[model samples]
Target: MGIFKRVKHMATADTNHFLDKMENPVSMVKQYIRDLEEQMGQAQQALAQQYWNERRYEAQIEETTALIMKRSRQAELAVDRQEDAIAELAIEEKLRNQEKLALYKTQHEATKNQTAALLEQMKRMNEKYNELVLQKQNLLSRIRAAQAIQASTAALQPYDMDRVHHGLARIEEKVWQVEAQAYAGIKAGEVLNAAPSYVEQEKRDEIQKELAALKEKRGTV
Candidate 1:
């Protein structure tokens, strides 16, 4: 309604149009893929770290279980030797190792589950990313087809073709006029050459007069 408002609206529209033109599908898709790859890489790294923790927990559980067995054997030997102090110490160490083994086992199971879930998530992301790539290819093919059709349509525009035809018609008319002029000149030349010349007709008439005079002179008129 207002001039300033109209100007502002026009400017915004123009900016949006410019941005749309600048937004190339290929570049946009490539950027999107790059971002997806980055995220996937980060996810993979985190999964790898999780797997490392699980392995560490497993190693710790194995070591702790071995220590617990060793302590139990040591406690039994001490008891057989009637060494109460050594047996008590071995029993305490076995209990601590057992606790450590339990904690390690729990952590290992939790980490293993988390790693499995992350792997499934990563698989889904890869599938989706592949689908996006295929869609990009399809989009490009359609765009190319549309561009070709648009170019052909532009070349065959009726108004442009009409102008071409009009130019050809003008040239044809000029050629016809030139041919007509040449034909007219040939006809005129033929008519002039077909008739007797004035000088030749006069010469014939003079010869006839002379013959009549000669006959009269001879008295054979």
Candidate 2:
């Protein structure tokens, strides 16, 4: 009972101190599994020893019983005082071994039961650990998706919008330049646009000389 009491105290730890050494959920779960395996192994070993002790106690009891029976037969043949004492001591030893054998059998069962319960606890803890692992993976996946979407949106946000505005402004300036060139040509004067050749100048001078003779004849007649 004393040994089991100490072990019980170690196994029953639940809060703060038990979790203080754990760094993360995965490491915590692994450590918990390891500790559970160690405890189960120890309990099983104790159970095995208890069974061996029971068997040895039984064998000793049988040997002592045989000794007691042989001495009884000898005492019946010769009623010696020392022989009677020997027979009585043999009976007491047999009773002691019997008691020990029963106690060991009980201890073996208790150890086996403790091991089984710990195994069940380990099973439940494993299920919980797996669930938490899945949750962490899902959260990571969602976070990645969210980051990608944010990056895409930022690329499309048009942060440097002045570039497009400047392009349109340059196009308008080119149109005004073309319009100004057309107006400038119109203002340069029509004479510069259509100058007569030397042959057209001679024809104009001959027509002016004929008009001067007609005017002289009309005045003398």
Candidate 3:
């Protein structure tokens, strides 16, 4: 059986899921460069194998050529001896070997073309990966500048003073309510830590009621 016999096994071999888990752009770019390097290595290895195969084919062709020439010389001797059948068989064997050799020659040419294309692709991938790395650094610097500017602007906002004063007013009112509730509980002869501020609630309610009564009185007038 060939490698990767099970279809499910092939899906796990891909690393896209793991690559997506990386949150940092710089780390992602670095990992991508590593993946490209591995691909480049594999392509170079294939090219080397093709180069070796081509050399083996060249040697095979030379060996076969020498063998044919030697047999042809032998055939000349056989013809002089008038052994026609033996010479015919020898020539036929040479023809078969030459045909096989030509097939290997064509295959070698195809492999050469494939290897050249792979090398070009590897070169392009390397260039693109380098460009991404450079761009990543430039982007990181700009991000830092943007973050610094945002922090500086937040630290120097005029509206922040209003926010602080509003918060302090809320806290002061809560403190006064607490004190009033404690005084009310003591006056009512209750053994309690505190209660809701009756005096403050009453005062705020009376003010609102008087404002409403004044509006009604003016409306009638």
Q: Candidate 1 — what's its lDDT?
A: 0.78
Off by over 4 Å in 3: 1-23, 159-221
Q: Which stretches of candidate 1 lie over 4 Å from their true place?
A: 1-22, 159-165, 195-197, 211-221
Please list the Cα RMSD from the true structure of every candidate, rounded to 1 decimal place: 10.5, 8.8, 20.0
Candidate 1 worst ten-residue window by lDDT: 7-16
Error of 1 at 154 (Å): 2.8
Give the Cα lDDT of each candidate: 0.78, 0.61, 0.71
lDDT per residue as tens, model 2, 1-221: 54455346545556345545656544564565565556556655665675565566556556655765665565554445466666566556656655665665666566556656555554544454455456556645776898999999988886666987898899999999999998887876555655565557788888877778888978942
Q: Which tens-of-lDDT digit does each residue in 41-137 have in candidate 3?
A: 7667767887898788788778877887877887788888999998898888878877877887787788788667666665665666566567568
TM-score of 2: 0.45
Which of the numbered candidates is closest to the native, going by highest lDDT? Answer: 1
* Model 1, backbone clash pairs (residues 3+ apart or across chains), number: 0
The collision pairs in model 3 are none
Q: Candidate 2: what lDDT?
A: 0.61
